[model samples]
Target chain A: MPEAEAGTLVLDCDELEELAGALALGAALPQEVAAAQAHLDGCPRSHTDVYELATVARLLAEAPEPVEPPARLRARILATAREDTAPQDAPSGIRYPVSGGGGPVPGTARAPAPARSSLPRRPVFFLLAAAAALAALALGLWNLQLRGELDQRQERLAAQQRFIDAFAGGGRSVAFAPAPGQEALHGAVVRRAQGPALAVFTALPRPAGSDVYQLWAIRGSTPQDLGVFVPDARGHHIATLPDLTGVDAVAVTLERERVPAPTTAPILTAPL
Target chain B: MATGDGPAVSDPDAALLARLVTRDEAALAELYDRHGRAAHALALRVTGNAETAQDVVQEAFLALWRRGHTYQPERGAVRGWLLTVVRNRAIDALRGSGGQVARVLPVDTLVLAATDNPEAEAMQAVDGRRVRAALAALPPEQRDVVELAYFGGLAYPEVAERMGIPLGTVKSRMRLALERLRGSLRAWERDA
Candidate 1:
């Protein structure tokens, strides 16, 4: 129907990240695996590459003059390890000097709380996991209710898969809460530990003609421009963040034209 | 090393891992005592904060403790896994991290520390020259992407976004970069 829709989307076969990941995790299609195997069958170096890349990665860690961790940290970590729970699910005591406040709720344009972001504690994990699971479970039930609309079901499944993969590899996601009146809008900032954070929004009301929605990474005082996007006909928007290395929070705003800076208050925000 | 996915219980770290699976605290301490410094230093460099690094390394070990059963020694060395875990944790810690910024990563300033990490000391002693040479030989842009992914923990997609390059380009660069490094790294093995 549209010129832009002429081509089909395909995974880049040569993407090293995807290839290497598929090799290690067995996440690739059969031929992909075969291709890798045929290449590595000569020496079977793929798995070992994980460790070898890890060792090269080790060179980075070993760089930067070793600052022997303070002796007390040893005592503290060892003592915590001795908790006898056989790897307590995210020991609460791990993050010493916890950032007390949960950071201001996103959408408030509040101070970026760097201290606020810490690894998801056990309860946080359980709650987030529960929420995600409930979301996924609910989608299946919803699919059952709506027997038709196969396209919508596929989209829902896609979203659910994105949510699951967000939590994969020990990454975390922050849910986006829209204004109370805007119940239809939904989204999340998936902070991937091993990759770029993703800002996924669904049911985003299409911006009026020529206007677009822009994503912004709100650092302390500056808002770094991510990119502007228009959701597909299905009103689904997923944007790849460059990386959330030092981002405080991420937000979305409506723009008549994507500008170097935000011209209006953000319509949505997810505090990292 | 066998290519098959066989249990490497005979490996020293494998032995420690077995003890860890058995819930042996002594094993944890032993593993920590050996790798803890490197782990801590790795986290510290990544997060650039002492407390956070401690927190990261602690969590990584705990995760390793929990997930140690999943380790396949034929995949790679145990210490490599340990370092990668700590590095990932430290990188995760950087999200929404506070205080004085290293601003951007100083990719050029990477300097090997005085000896302490046994695996590092050994690897650095033998393979350091060749590996460093391999890494240095990579195109500045290619090396930058690899360093960003490996040291910064940004995945390839993130690296593409950071460098404003196409995903294909990033992958090709890394494929080339790692191919060269693999040649150098392939020679230095566990026994080597």
Candidate 2:
């Protein structure tokens, strides 16, 4: 047990219970948060308990495979980021409304600032200054655009890292063998947590036309498409199954573009 | 999966934050791309409105931009920190007005996906399906209290009020639920 400081109150067991619940959910009132922090400053045991509880809360937050955000939200966030990076004096004259309407932001449509009268008043000097200003603006905008793309790539990699992390531990793997004349083909499906399934294949044949290998999760008589993929030169293919819960079997088939449903029999499968 | 035993010297988040302190927008956007979905989902679940959830997510990221200095990685994973901010903001929105705002659920990525922890790796790898199943296994009474307090973001007294139960009962239910959850996840660890 930790002692309370002057003008501070230590949480008892019941209060600690409430603090844990609030901390896990991020719903603690400001005063409650302050109080909890105060107590934690003096208590090591309580801190560990709170940390573990928060981990459980995080697990709940991530139980679902994923839901894609509206396309415009990404644009809106990037637009705001650009505005924030705009030169302090000029305040990049752009804005994207947070309402997500994809409408132009208000108070952003404005004419360029007038030149300060302190500069040389000659026409040639004025033109030169304007050119210099334009060049600087172009450079800044170009940098912003480049940074945006790099940021987008970094995010995609981070997402992939998470996808890999999802099965980095505690997933079960099942092997798939080739059928009949397809003795060269070998595959495996790693079932992760609840629904994400990672499938890997080797020695797959390249399909002609727009045909590609599509993965499926078979439960009872019905089957669902996990995703589609193409094998590499060594004939290796790996695909992620977003939602594979209730899957009694896993299979892969070759299908042409625009085909929503399975078009051919599975060349490989791992029955759960 | 990366283990907590190793030094976090090469932690990507620490590197990202270092860049962010230099006012790098790319680092911020990359951070958002990594954790935005989970943060958005938590806000949506709590605030019960897509718009409010979006606002909460944006606010959380901006706060990170402004307060990156406050973060201490040794305390916990960055995803947990972002989700906590979102949840707190959602609660503020809800409590400030007696209005319902958004309703949505889980999304494409786990926030703590790249952290070095077997539990996190296993949870994400397994999606803590067992933990969810264990939660589902609890008696509905116990489950209700846990959900109301955790997901619902209601204080214990509010949880009791919402369920028409005694405050003491709510406390006991929460205690029991947490003990059961710890036992269940620990059991899963051993089985793994």
- Top candidate on lDDT is 2
Over the stretch A1-272, how does candidate 1's per-residue lDDT look in tens digits?
11112121122324333455322221223233323333332333334443343334445444444456778876776677655353222111111010001111112221111122244334345767888979977998887777766667577757855754655457777866543334345688877777667777766767655567778776553455677888887677788877576667787765544444443346676778
lDDT of 2 at A162: 50
Tens digits of lDDT, candidate 2, A1-272: 24443323356655765556444444343334444544554455634555555556555654432445666666677666545532212112111111100111111111112123444333445677888979977998889998998787667545544544445357766776444334345667777666557786655667654456767666543344466777887676778765555667887655433122342345676787
Task: Tell me the lDDT of model 2 at A102.
Answer: 12
- Model 1 misplacement above 4 A: A1-65, A84-272, B1-10, B96-133, B186-192
Worst 10 residues of 1 chain A by lDDT: A93-102
Shift in Å, residue B78, candidate 2: 0.9
lDDT scores in order? 0.53, 0.54
Across B103-162, the per-residue lDDT of candidate 2 in tens digits comes to: 211111111222345554444333435656778888899888877766675766677678
Best-matching candidate per DockQ: 1
The stretch of ten residues in a row with the least summed lDDT in candidate 1 chain B is B105-114
